[model samples]
Target chain A: MSEAVLSIRNLTVEIPTRGGILRPVDQINYDINRGEILGIVGESGAGKSMAGNAVIGLLNRPAKITGGEIWLNGTRIDQLEGEDMRRLRGKHIGMVFQDPLTSLNPLLRIGDQLTETMLEHLDISRDKARKRAAAALDEVGIPAAAQRLDSYPHEFSGGMRQRVVIALALCAEPSLIIADEPTTALDVSVQAQIIALLKRLCRDRGTAVMLITHDMGVIAETADRVAVMYAGRLAELGNVRDVVTHPEHPYTDGLMGSTPLASKGLKRLRQISGSMPRLTAMPEGCAFHPRCEFAQDICRAEPRPKLNGGRSACHFPIQQPAEETA
Target chain B: MAMIQVKNLTRIFDVSKPWLNRVIERLPKAMLTAVSDVSFDVEERTVYSLVGESGSGKSTIGKMAVGLLKPTDGSVLINDIDLSRETDGGKLDKARSDIQMIFQDPYASLNPRWRVREIINEPVSARGGNVVGLAEKLLEQVGLSSLDADKFPHEFSGGQRQRICIARALASEPKLIVCDEPTSALDVSVQAQVLNLMSDLQENLGLTYLFISHDLTVVQHISDKIGVLYLGRLVEEATPDELFENPKHPYSQMLLAAAPKMDGFGREIDPPQGEIPDPINPPTGCAFHPRCPIATAKCSAERPEMRVVRGARVACHLAE
Candidate 1:
C-alpha cells in the first residue's frame, strides 16, 4: 500500500501489570494507501481496537506504545509532543468512536462541539466554523442541520447521533480516518448507510480509512484489504476477497465459519471453542493456539516468525511463503 | 392450531411533552408508537423470529408475547388464553408459565449480587413447584457446569452470563421462550455458542421460540419462519428459506439489501431510499411508502391489507 497515507512499523503496545509488562499489541507493520479502506477484523478483545487506539495515540492509561514508527503522511506521529499531536488529530487524522454518546459532549450544543474542534485545529473564525459545522452535518445526511446544530446529543436518536459524530470527525477533512467499531452500536440499516457514507466520502475526498471492527461482512463490503488480528497479533493480511474467501490463518477461517450469514439458513454454525486467553499472560508461541483447531506443538513452543518485517501474520505466514515460492 | 398468536399488537408511549408542559407551552400532545398493528402466529414447538432494524418493534413483539408488556391494542393469546390480568388466575398462570422471557443484556438482566443458584431459583420458587436440584440441573442443561451455580454473574464472561439467563428462563419449564436479542450483547465467537445452545435446547426440550432481533443473518441461522416488522407493523412473514430467497415485500427487500452481505465481495445492494417513517404519525397509508423503491401512488392513499403473495404474507400495494 505504498503511496501510503499512514505507515505503521514494528508497532508494539504493553500494559503495566503486577506480574510484568503485558503485551496487548505485539510488533506489527502495515500501511494504508491514500483514500483506501483498510479493514481490521477479529473477535472482541483481539487487540484489533488496541491497534487503532495506538495509531490515534488514544491508548488508555497503564498502556504504553513501547516501540514503533507511526508515519502519518510523511510526519512521524508516534513521537510528536502533546500540542503537536493535538493539532494534528482533528486537522489531519479524524476518528469515529464506537459509542457516539461517550465520544460526544452530552451537555454541549452540537454546533459548539463541532466548532470547538475547528477552533482548536483551524485558524477559521467562529462564524465560518459554525457554518462549516452545519454543512458537515448536512454532508453526513443529518436533516435540518442548521436547527439541529443547537441541540444536545441526547436530543437526537441513536442513528442521528452517530451521524453527528461522523460529521464532527469529517469537518476537519482529515487525511486519515480511524473508525473503531463505528457501526457496531447502530442498527443494521443505519449501519449500512453509515458504511456507505464513509466509503463514498473517502472516495470523493481521497481520504484513507482504517476500519476497526469484528464484523467480517462490513470488511468484505467496504474494505479494499483486510488485516485480521488474533490475541494481540496480526494473524493474516491480504486483499479483502482473498483473505475472507480463502483465509490463511486458522483464526480468520474460524471467524468466517462462525458468523451467521443472510443467505445461509437453519444450519449450525462452526463455533470456535474456548475463550481467548487474558492479555496479561498470552500463550508463549502463538497466542491463537489455544483455540486453533489446526494447532501443533510448534505453535506453542516459540514466537511465530515475523514476516511483514514486524507484522505477526501467524507462526507460519501464509501468503508470504507462497509468494516467495512463486 | 398455533401455540401463540398476536393480533393487531400496538404499544404507544406518552413520549410527548407532559400535559402540564404542553398546556404551558401551548403545544400539541404527541405519542410515540413503538409498535402498531403488528400481527403474527407461532407454530407449536417451532422457532418464529421477528427481525428488523433498531426501533422497528421486534423487541416489543417479543415482550408482548411473554406478557412482559401489555398491548395497547388487540390481544396476545397463549394456549388460547388472553394475556391479561383480568383473566382467571389458573389461565393467567398457565399463559405466563408457558412463555418465559430472556432479555438482551445478560449482564444487566442477571442479578450481579446474587449467586447463580438464587438467580435460577427465583422463577421456580415463584411458581411454588419444585424441581429437585433444579439449579444444578439448569446449569447443566445450559451447557454450564453444576459448580457454576455458586458463582456470581460477574465472574462469568458475556456468553456464560447469557447461558445462565437461558438456564434461568428454562428453569420455569416454559413451553415457549421469548429471546429478545439474546446474543447481540455477546462477541461473535460467543454468539455462535449461545445460538447453538438455544437450538439444541429447543430440540431436546421441545421448547418453542419467539426470537426477536435486528440481525437478519443470525435469525436466518435459527429461525424456521421469519416476520419482518417496520415501524411496529408486521410488513411481511414467510418461512426463513422462502422469505430470504424470494422476499416479496418492499420493506423486506429494503431490509435484505441493507443487510451487509456475507459473500466474499460485491457492490452493496442499493439500500431503501429513505429514513424510517415516524411511528406515531406514520405516513397516511403505508408507513414504508416514503422509502419503498417500488412505491405506487395507491400505496400512499390506501392501507394495503396483508395478503398472501406467492406464498408469503405481505403488506404492500404492489404485492399480489
Candidate 2:
C-alpha cells in the first residue's frame, strides 16, 4: 500500500465491567497510506471510535488495548507509555474531537493554544511559533489570521472555532490525524466548509487521516477507502466507491439502504431490524446474524467466513462480479 | 382547509444583559428577531417540514406552534382557535389538547425519575382520564410491550425512547404534533426505524406533523410539503418532489447542492460559502444575499417577499 503511514494489526480494546470483561473492539486490521483518508463507519457503540482512540493511546479509563499492535511509519507505538506516548502524540499524531470547545481551552486565546502545541513538538522559538501559528490559521481559511491570534475561542463562531481547532491540530505537523466526528457539531452548510478545508489541508501536506463517523454521506464524499464495523468487528473494507455502491457485507448494505439518500421513491426504508448487541450479550456465531436478511442455518453456527480477500467477513457476501456490471 | 394556520408569526428575543450593563457598555438594547413575519399553513393529515441550519428560527417556530413559547407579534390559529386571542377557557383547553410536541433530545425530554407509564400517561391524567389502560395501549402502539411501561427511560435505546415520545404525544389524541429535529440526534439506521414508525402512525391515525430539522435528506424523505427557512424568513416553500427536483431560491439551491449525497461518490463538491450573518445585526435586505452566488444590487437593497412561481413560493428578486 505504498509505504503505509499508519498500520493497525489485530487491534482489540477491552473494558473490565462489573458484568464481565467487555471487548468493545475486536481484532480489527487496516492500513492508511500517506495522504489517504480512511473512513470508519458504524452505528453507536460499534467501536469505530475505540479503534481510533487505541491508535492515539487515548483510550478512556477502565478501557485499554489488550491485544495487537499499532505501527506508525515502521515504528511500534502501542507499547509506548507516559512521556514517550505524550511526546509521540503531538509530534507524530494529532487528534480532533467532536466538540471543539472541549479540545480548546476557553480562557486562552486561539493563538496561545496553537503556539503552545507547536513549541512543545518542534525546536522553535516563541516568535517563530507565533508566526507559524498565524500561517496555519490562514491555511485553514480563517480570515484576518494575524488579528484573530488575539481573539479567544468565545469570540469566534462555531465553524470558525472548529477551524481554529483544526489549525491547532495541524500546527504540530503530525503525519497522521484522528478526527472523530469533526463536523458533526457544525451546521450542514458549515459542515461542507469544514470538510472541504480538512480535505484540502491534508492533501497539500500529504498527511493521512482516520475519519471516524456515523455518516456514510461524509465518507462517500471524502474518504479514499471505507471500513464498515458492526458490533465491534470489521464487517467490510474496500475502496469507498465500491463499498458505498455495492457493499459486500449485508450489514453495510443495510446501513446504506437505511440512509435517507438511498430511500428515494421507496415507501419504507430497508432497515436492519434490531439494534447492535450489547457487549455482554453478543450472539454465539456472527454478531450480525440475528439481523441479517440472508442469514442461513450455517450463519448462526459458524464464526465469520473469510472472503476471497480480506474485503468482507460474511458467510455469504454479496457477489462482486455481478455488482460491477449492475 | 388548513388544520393549523400561522399568519405573520414573529418572535423576538431580548438578548441584552441588564439595563445597567447596556448603559455601561454604551450599547443599545440587543434584540434577536428569531422568526420574523413568517406565515404558513399545515394541511390535515399531511407532513409539513421546516428545513434550515441553526439560528434560522425553525425550532423557535416549532415552540410557537405548540404554544410552548408565545410570539412577540402575529397570530397562530389552530383549527380556527386563535392561540393568542382565545379568551374563552373552553376553546383554549381544546386547542391545547389538539396539539402536542416532541423535542429533539429524547434523553432530556422524558423525566428520568418517572417510569414509562407515568411519562406516557401525563397527558391523559392531566385531563382526569384513566392513565393505566391508556398507558398500556400506547406502549403497545409504539412497538414496545405493555410491560415496558413499568421500566425507566434509561433502560431503552435512543430509538426506543423516541418511540416512547411518540406514544406520549399520541396519548392526548392530538391532531397536530410538532416534532423538532426528532431524528437529528439519532444514528442513521435508528433514524430510519423511527421515521418509518412515524410514517406508519400518520397513516393509521390520521396525524398531521410539523417536522423541523436541519438534515435535508431526512426532511425530503418525510415531508409532503417543505419550507426552507433562513435568518427568520421563509425563503422557499413547495412540495418535496417539486423543490428537490428544481429549487427556485438561490439559498435553497445552495442547500441542496451542499447536502452530502451517497449517489455522487468521489465527485468533488463545491462547499457552501460564507457563514450565516449575526442575527442581532443581520444584513439590511435579504439575509442570504451576502453569500448568494447569484446576487444583484436589488437583492442587497430590498428584501424579497414570497411570490407564487411554478407552483411554489420563492423569495428571491431574481427567482422566475
Candidate 3:
C-alpha cells in the first residue's frame, strides 16, 4: 500500500450559535497519500473550508473540533496545542488562501517574508536564506527574482502575487500543502498557470496537497481523488475519474449536471430544486434526503448512511447502466 | 431594426497622478482607453454577450450601452434615439425609461435599508407611475413569494437577492436590460435557476439583454451571439456554435483551450504565454501581438481590422 501522508478519521466540527449548536463538518473521513492531490468540492455552506481549518488548528473561537483524529505523517495532530501547532504550520504544513493580499504582509518586501519564514523553521544563516528566497521565486517562474526581491506585494500583478504566495508556502519545505480556492480570484489564463505550477511542485517534491475548491473543472484536471461534501457530511469519495465521470450520489449527479460545459451545446442547465439546508435547520434523518431524488421512506426515517467500505454515503448508489459498463 | 446600436463607442479614463505629484515626478498624463472604438448591435429580444478577462473593458462597454457612463467619443442609439446627444428632455427621458440595468454582486446592488417592495417599486414610483401591486406581481413572476416583498435585502440569500434585483429591473417594463455577471456570484445550481428565469423572462416579455461576463461556459450557454474581447478590443464575434467549434482568432482559440474541461482529466496542455498587457501602454499595432503564438513583422507594424472570415468576424491578419 502507498504511504498515507495525511489521514483524517471521522472528523467533526461544531459551532455554538444563539439559535443552536451547528455541526459544520460531520463525520468526514479521507486519506491523502504522499505526492497526491485530494480535491474537496461543495457549495458555499457545505463545511469544506471548516474541515481544512480544523486540520490546521485555525478554527475560530465558538467553533471547535468536537471529535476526530488528524494524523500527519503518523503523528496525531488533532490534540496539538498553540505553540506546537504554530511550529507545525510553517515547517510541516503550508497554506495558500483564496486572496493573495491577505496571506502576504503588504508592508514587507517579498524577500523579507520568505527569508523570515525560512529562518524561523529551517536552521540556516540569514545570508543563505535570502539567497534561497530569490531561488524560490525563480522556481515559481517569476522573472528577475533577484532584483524584484526588494519590491513590496503591491508591486506585482494579481497572477504574479499568487506565484509569490506559492513560493512563500513552499519556502519552508513542508510535507503538505492546504490550498483553499487558490485560483478562484484569478482569470482563466492565470488560473491555468497556477494549477500547472502546483501540480508540478507536488510531483517534484512529493508533497501531499489538500486542494479545497468549488470548481469542478479545476478538480477534474488537477485532483487524483475527490471528496464530495453536502450539508456538512461526506456525500461521496472515490477516484477522480469515477467520481467525476459517473457520480454515485444523487447530489453529485445534480451538481455535475448543473455546471454548464463549454463543450456541450446550448441547453437549459439541470438545476437542483432548492439551496443547501442551513446548519441550524438541518433535517432529522439524512441531511440530503429532502433535496435528493432517490430518497425513500427509509432514507427519511433512518440515520444518514456511512461510507462503511463503500464509495457513497446514501441509501441507494446509482449503478452503472449495463450498456455503458459493457 | 436593432433594439440597441453601439457605434464607435469609446471611453478614456485619466489614471495619472494628481497634478502636483505628476509635476514633481516629471510624469506625463496616463490615459486608459477602456472601450476603444467598439461597435455591436443587439436585435430585438436577442441575447448578446461580451466576454473577456478582467480589465478587458467588457464591463465598461456594458456601462456605455446603458448610458450610465458618457462616452468620450461616439454614441449609443436605442430605438433610433441617442441618449447622450439628444437635446430634447422628453425624448431623452423616454429613452432612458426604456432601458434598465442589473448589476453583479447581489449583496451590494440591493439597498439594505429598504424593504424589497420599496426597492422594486422605486423605478416606477420615481417616474410618477402607479406602483400598486407591482412589487408582488413581479416577485411572483421571478419565482419569489409575494410575502418576500416586506423583508429587507439582508433577509435573503445571494440567489434570492439576485431574483429581487431582476424583479426591480422588470418593474419598469424596459425594452432592454443590461446584465453584468448576474450569475457569477451564485453557486452552480442556483446559477442554473437564475439563468433559466432570465431566459423565461426574455421569451415572455420580449426583452433584449446585453450580457457581460468573464465566464465562457455560462456565456456560451446563454448568449445568442458572443463577442470575444482582449485589452479593450473586439477580436472575434460569432454564434456560440461557430465560436466554440471553429474559432478563427488565436486569442479566442487560446481562451477556449485554457478553460478547464469536465472530460479533460489527466490531459496536459501547454500554458498560454504571457499575461494581459498593461492597458495604458498597450502594444503599438495589434494589442495581442505580444502574446500571439504566430506573430510576424506585419502583425507588429499594422493593426488588423474586423473582417468577415469563415462565417465569423475576426480581427487577425493571418486568420484567412
Candidate 4:
C-alpha cells in the first residue's frame, strides 16, 4: 500500500486500577491509506473505540495509551504535547461519533459548529467559512442547507443531524475521518442512504475513512479493508472481502454466520454461543477461548493473541475458504 | 379461529393547534391519522409482523392492540373480545393481562433504578398472579442468570436488557405478546439470541405474537405472516414466504428491495423512493402512490381496498 495517512503501530491502552494496570487494548497495528476505508469490527468493549480515541487524542481519562506510536503522515502523534495534538486535530484529523445529538452542543446552531472548525483550522474569514458551511451541508445531502444552517440539533431529524455532523467533519477537509458507528442510530432505510452518502463522499474526495462499527453489512458495502477486534486485541486484519467473506478467526467467522443476510432465506441464523466476557479480568490465553468451538488446551495458556499469521493471536485459525465461510 | 382480529382499526391523534388558535388562524383541526382502516388477524401461536417506516403507524397499531391507546373507529378483537374506548375497567384489565407489549427502547421501557427482579415481578405482584420461582425461572427462560435479576438495568448489555424485557413480558403469562421492535436496539449477535429466545418461548408457552418492526430481514425470520403498513393503513398482508417471494404491491416490493440483503450480491433494483407522506394530511386515494414508481393516475384518485391476490391481501389498483 502507498504511504498511509494514519499509521498505528504497536498501540496498546491500559486502564490503571487499585490492583494493577488492566490492559484494555493490546498491541495492534494498522494503517489507513490516503483514500482507503479501513473498518474496525468487534463486539462492544472490543477496544475498537479505544484504538480510535488513542489515535484522535481523545481517549477519556483513566484510560491511558501506555505504549504505542501513532504516525500521522510520518509525524509521531502519540508523543505530541497537548497543544500540538490540539492544533493537529481539525486540520489533519476529523472525528464523527456514533451519537450525533451528543457530539454537537445542543445550544449552538448548525452553522456555528461548521464555521468554528473552518475558522480554527483554515485561517479564513467568517463569511468565507459561512459560505463553505452551506456547501458542506449540501455535500452531505442535507436539504435546504442555507436555511438549515441556523437550526439547532433539536430542530433537525435523526438522519439530518448525522448529515450535519458529517458536514462539520468534512468542512475542515481533514485527511483522515474516524467515524464510530455513524449510522447505527439511524433506521435501516435511512441507514442505507447515510452509508451511501458517506461512502460516496469519501470516495470522490479521496479522503481516508476509519469506519468503526459492529455491523458487518456496513463493512461489506463501505470499507475497503476490515480489522476485527476482540477484548482489546486485533483478531484479524485483511482486505474487506478477505476478512468479511474469508475470515480466519473463529470469532469473525461466528459473527458472519450469525448475521441474517437477505440472500439467506428460511435457514436459521447462527449465533456466537456466549456473551462477551467482562473486560475487568480477561482470560489468560485467547480471550475468545471460552466461546470458540475448536479451542484446545494450548489455546488457553497465552495472555494475548498474535498480530500476524494472517489472523491475530490464534494458535489454530479456522481454515475455511472464502466461499466456505459463513 | 384467529387469536387477534383487527377490522378497520384507526387512531387519529389530535396533534392540531389548540382549539382557540385554530379558530383565529382560520385553519381546521390538524389531526394526524396515524393508523387508517388497518385490518388483519393474527393466528393463534403464530408470529404476525407489521413492517413499515416511522410515522407509518406500526407502533400506533401495536399500542391499540394492547389497549394502551383508544382506536378512533373500528375494532381490535383479541380472541373475539372487541377492545375499544368503551371497554370498561374489568374487561380492559383482563385484555391487558392477556396481551403484554415489549417496547422499542429497552432502556425506556424498563426502570433503570429498579432491580431486574422487581421489574419483572411488578406485573406478577400487581395482577396477584401465581408465578412461583419467578425471578430465577424468568432469567433462565430468557437465557440470563438468576444473578442478573438482582442487578440493575445498567449492568446488562443492550441484548441482555432486552432479554430482561422479554422476561418481564413473560411474567404475566400472557397469551399474546406485542413485540414492538424487540431486537431493533440490539447488536446482530445479541439480536439472534433474543429472536431465538422469543421463538423458543412461543413454542414452550404456546404464545401468539403481534411483532412490529421496520426491518424486513428480521421480520422474515421471526414472522409467520407479514403486513406492510403505509400511513397507518395495511398495504399488504401475507405469509412470510409469499410476501418476500412474490410481493404484489409496488410499495411492498420497494420496501423488500430497500432493506440491505447480506446475500443479494447487490443486484440493481430501484429502492422505494420518496419520503413518507405526512400522516396529518395523507395523499388522496393510496397514501403510498406518491412514493410508488409504478403508480398510475388511477392510484392517485382511487384507494384500492386490500384484497386476496395470490393468497395475500394487497391494496394496489395495479395489482388488481
Candidate 5:
C-alpha cells in the first residue's frame, strides 16, 4: 500500500476566550494516502475548517494547537513555526480556499502569479516557470491559456478565475492539497467542472487532498473517505460509501437525512431540530445530544465518547460494523 | 386566475463605459439584456421556481416580479393589476401590499440597529396600519418566541434570522412572496428547517411563491413548476417530476447532470463544454448555442420559441 501523505493524530485546537478555552478542534485522528481525498464534513462552527487551518498553520492568534501531532510525508510538523512553516506551505501543502477573488491578488496577472509561486517553491529558471505556468493553465482547461496569461484577475469570469486558482494551487506541485469549500461560491456547472478538475489533477499527480465542506453531495462524488465532525469532534470516519450509505453517528445520519436528494421526490426533509450548540454553552455530555433523537441518560451524563477502534464516537451507533452484526 | 402574471418581461441595463472612456476606447454602447422577453405565471398558493446559473437573470426576474425594479419593457401583474401601468393610486397600493419580497442574505437584509419588533412591524407601520403586537404574533407564527420580538437581530443564529425575515415578509400578509435564493446561504440542516417552514407557511397562508435559486435539489423539492433559465431566456418549464425525470432542453439536461448528487458515487460526467456566455453580448440566435453540445446551423442562425415537447415546454429545436 502507498504510504500516508498526511497523518493527523489526536489533534486539538483551542481558542482562549474570556468565557473559557473553546476547543474548536477536539482530539481527532485521520490519515490521507497518496492520491486519496478525505472529506471533512460538518456544519458551521463544527471545526472542519479549523482542523484544516490547524494543519496549514494558518490558525489566527487566540487559537492555537494545544495538543497532538501533524505528520506530512513522515515529518513531524506540528511544532514548526514562522519561517519554516511559511516555507513548507507552498512547497509541500497547497491550499484552495472558498473564494477565488480573495485567494488571488487582484493586481497581478494570472501568469505572473503562477510563475511566481512556481519560482518560489521550485528550482526552475524564470523562462521555464513562465512556460510551465501557461501549461498549468492549459491543463486546467483554461481557453487560450497563452493569451490569458497576460490578463489580470478581474478580467476572467468566476469559473475561469477558479480554474486559475486551481492552477496556482497546483503550479508548485505540492504533494497534498487542503481545499476548504472550494466549490461553495461557484455555480452548479462551474462547481462540477472545478470538482472534476481538482479530482483529475490530484489523481494524476497522486496528491493527497483534505476536502473540507458542508455539502454531502460534493463529498459523495469526490471523496474517497469521509470524516464527520460535530462540535469539534470526529463523530464518524469510514469509507465514503459505507459512511454515506449507513451513517453510524446520529449527527452524520441527521445531516444525510436533511440534505434534499434530487432522486427523492417531494418528501419533507428530515431536519435535525435545533441548531449546533455554541462553544460557550456546549451541552453536558455529547454536544449533539440536545438535537439527537436517540440521546439517553449516559449521553447527557458522560463526556463525549471517543472512537476507540470504532467507526463512530457514539455510545450506541445507528449501524453496527459487519463483524459485530455477524 | 394566476396570482402573479409576468408577460414578456424584458430588462436591459446600460453596461457601457463612461462617455469619455467609451470614446477613448472606441467602444460601442453595451447593453446587457438581463431578462429577455420571459413570461411565466404563478397560480395562487403554488410555488413556481426559476433555476439557473449566475448571470442567467433569475434574481433580476425576482426583483422585477416584486416591483423592486421596473422592466425596460413588458409588465408584471400582481392579482390582475399591472404594477407598473396601473395609475390608480389606491388600487396600485392594494396590489403592492399583497406582494412582498424575501432577500437571500438574512444578515444583510435586516437593519442592524432596529429591534426585531420594529423590523417585523415596519411593513405594517409604514402604511399606518395597526402595528401593535403584530411583531409578536408573527414571531410566534414563524416558530420564534414572542419575547424574541424585543431582541436584536445579532442575538439570533442564521437560521433564526431567516425565520425573522420570513416573519417580516408575512407581516403585511402578502399573497405573493418572491424569495430569491432564500436558503442558499444556510447550512443543510438549517436549510431544511427553513424550507419546511416556508412550505408550511405557504400551505397555511395560501401564499404564492416565485422562488429563485441556483440549487436544483432545493428547487425540485419545493417548486410545483420549474423554469430553466439560460442567458436570460426561459429555455424550459415543467413540473418537478417531469423536469427531473426527463429534461427536454439540453441546458436543463446539463444542469441536472452537473448538479452533485448524494447517490452519484464515482459517476463520471464530461465537464460541461463552456461557461455561460457574456450577457452583454450574447450569441445571436440561442444564447446557449455556443455552449450547447448538439448545436447545429439552425441553432445559431435562428432562435427556438417555447413549444410543448412531450409534457414539458422546451425551447430547443432538436427537442422532440
Candidate 6:
C-alpha cells in the first residue's frame, strides 16, 4: 500500500503490577494504509485493545507506551503532549468503541454531540457544522437524520445509536479511526450494517481504520489485512484472504478452524488447548509456545522469533495454508 | 417424546416508575411484555436452540423454562409436569431436580465464597442424594480434574468457571438443561471447547438441552431444531438444515444474511435496513416488519400466524 496513513514501529505498552511488569502490548509493528482497514484480532487479554489504546494515547494509569514510535501521516505521535494528543484524537485519529451508550452522552442530543466534536476539530460556523452533522448522519444511513438529530441517545435504538456514533467519529474527517470492537455489542444484523457503513464511509473518505476485534468472522468480512495477536505479540500479519484462508501461524490456524462455519458441518471444532497465559505469567521466549501445536525447544529458549518480511513471529511459518492441512 | 414442553409462555415485566413518581408524571401503569405466547418443545436427548438479538425474549423464555422466572401467562412442562401450576412441595422439588439452569455469566453465577465441591453438591445435597465423591466425578465428567473440586470459583479462569457451572448443572442429573448463552462470554476457541464438551455429553448421557444464543453459527452447529425470535415473538422454527438452507421468514433471512461467514472474506454485506422497533409499543402488527426487507402493507396491518411452509414454521405472509 502506498502512503501509509498510520504506522507503528515496535510499539510496546507495559503496566507495573504487584507481581511484576506486565507487557500487555509487546513490541509489534504494522501499518494502516490510506483507505485500508487493518484488523487486529486476538482473544481477550491478547493486547488488541491495549495496542489500539497506545495508538490513541488512551492507556490507563501506569500502563505506558515504553518503546517504539506511532507515526500518523509521517508525524511521530507517540510523544505528543496532552493537549496536542487530545486535539489529535478528534481531528486526526477518531475512535469508536464497542458500546455506543458509554461513548455518547445520554444527557445531550445527538446533534449537539456531533456539532460539538465538529466545532472542536474544524474551525467552521455552527450552521455549517449542524448541516455537516445531518449529512454525516444521513451518510451512515440513519433515516430522518435531520429530525432524529434532536433525539437523545436513549431515544434511538441500539443500531441507530451506533450509526450516530459512527457519524460522530466521521464528522471530524479524521484520517485514521481506531474502532475497538465497534460491532461486538450489536446484534448480528446490526453488526453487519455498522461494519458495512464503516467500510463504505471510510473508503469514500480515504480513512484508514484499525479495527480491533476478537471475532475472526468480522475480520474476514471487513478487513483488508489481518494481524493475529497472541499473548501481547503479533502472531501473524498478512492479506485477509491469505491469513484467514492460508494462515501461516499455528495460532491463526487454530482460530480459523475453531469458527463454526456452515461448510465445516457439525463436527467438533478444533480448540486451542489451555487459555492464554496471564500477562504476569507469560511464558519465556514465545508467549504462545505453551499452546502452539508446532512449538519446539527453540521456541521456549529463544527470544521472540521474527519471521521473514516481518509477516509472522513464528519460528517455522507454515508453507501450506491451514485449509489444505485441515 | 418431548422432555420439555413450553406452551404459550409469556413473561411481562413492570418497567414503570414508582407509584408516586408515576402519578406525578401523569403516566399510566406500564408493562413490557418480554416473552409473549412462545411455544416450543425439546425432544428427549435433542438440542433445541432459541436465536435472537437482545430484547427478543430469548433469555426470558430460557429463564421461564428452568423455573428461574415465573411466566406471567403460560406453562412450562418438564416431563409432562406443569412448572407454573405445580402446587405440591414434593412435586415441585422433584420437577426442579429434573430441570437445571445454566446462566450466561459464569463469573457471577457461581458463589465466589463456595468451593467447587459445595457448589456442585448443592443440588444433590438438597435432594438427600449421595454427595460423597459427586463433585469429583462431575468435575471429571466435564473434563476438569478431580483436584479442581477443592478450589474456589475465583481461582479458575472464565472458561473453567463455565465448566464448573456445567458440572454443577450435571450433578443434579437433570433430564433437561436450559443453557442461556452458555459460551457467549468465552473466547472463540474456548467457546468451541465448551460446545464440543456439551455435544459429547449430550451424545453420551442422552441429555436434552434448550440452548439459547444470539450467535447463528453456534446455534446452527448445536441445534437439531431452531427458533428465531423477534421482539418476544417466534418468527421462524425449523431444523438447522432447513433454516440455513432456505429461511422463509424475512427476519430469519435477514439474520442469516447478516451472520458473518468466514468463507465470505472481503465480501460486501448488504444488511437489511431499519432497526428493531420499540418493544414497549412495538410496530402495529409484526415486530420485525419495520426491519424486514419484504414487508408489505398487510405485514403492518395484521400479524401472520406460524404456518407450515417448505417444511418450516414461518410467520411471514410472503413465505409460500
The residue pairs that clash in candidate 5, if any, are none
Query: lDDT tens string, model 3, B101-195?
Result: 99899999998899999999999999999999999999999999999999999999999999999999999999999999999999988998899
Question: Largest DockQ belongs to which candidate?
Answer: 2
Chain A TM-score values, per prediction: 0.91, 0.97, 0.97, 0.93, 0.96, 0.96
Candidate 5 C-alpha error for residue A69, in Å? 0.7
Residue pair clashes in candidate 3: none
Worst 10-residue lDDT window, candidate 3 chain B: B265-274
Evaluated with lDDT, which candidate comes out highest? 3
Report how far off residue A8 is in candidate 2 (Å): 0.7
Runs in model 6 deviating more than 4 A are: A308-310, A321-326
lDDT of 1 by residue, B1-320 (tens): 99987888788887788789999999887888898887788989899998887778888777777777888888888888888644588778777777788889988998889999999999988878785699999898888899988899999988989999999999888899989999988878889899989989999999999998888888888998999988877889999888888999978877887888767484755544556766768897888888777878998998888899888999988876
- List the candidates' TM-scores in order: 0.94, 0.98, 0.99, 0.91, 0.98, 0.96
**Model 6 agreement with the true structure over B186-238: per-residue lDDT tens digits:** 99899989999999998988889999999998999999999999999999999
Q: After superposing candidate 3, which stretches have Cα over 4 Å from the reference?
A: A323-326
Which DockQ-derived CAPRI band holds candidate 5? Answer: medium
Lowest-lDDT window of 10 residues in candidate 6 chain B?
B269-278
RMSD of 4: 3.0
Docking class of 6: medium
What lDDT score belongs to each candidate, Candidate 1 first?
Answer: 0.84, 0.91, 0.92, 0.84, 0.91, 0.89
User: Candidate 5: which stretches are off by over 4 Å?
Assistant: A320-326
Compose the digit string of candidate 3's lDDT tens values, residues A190-271. 9998999999999999999999999999999999999999999999999999999889999999898889872266467788
The Cα error of candidate 5 at residue B251, in Å, is 0.4
| TM-score, candidate 5, first chain | 0.96
TM-score of 1: 0.94
Question: How far out, in Å, is residue B116 in model 1?
Answer: 1.4
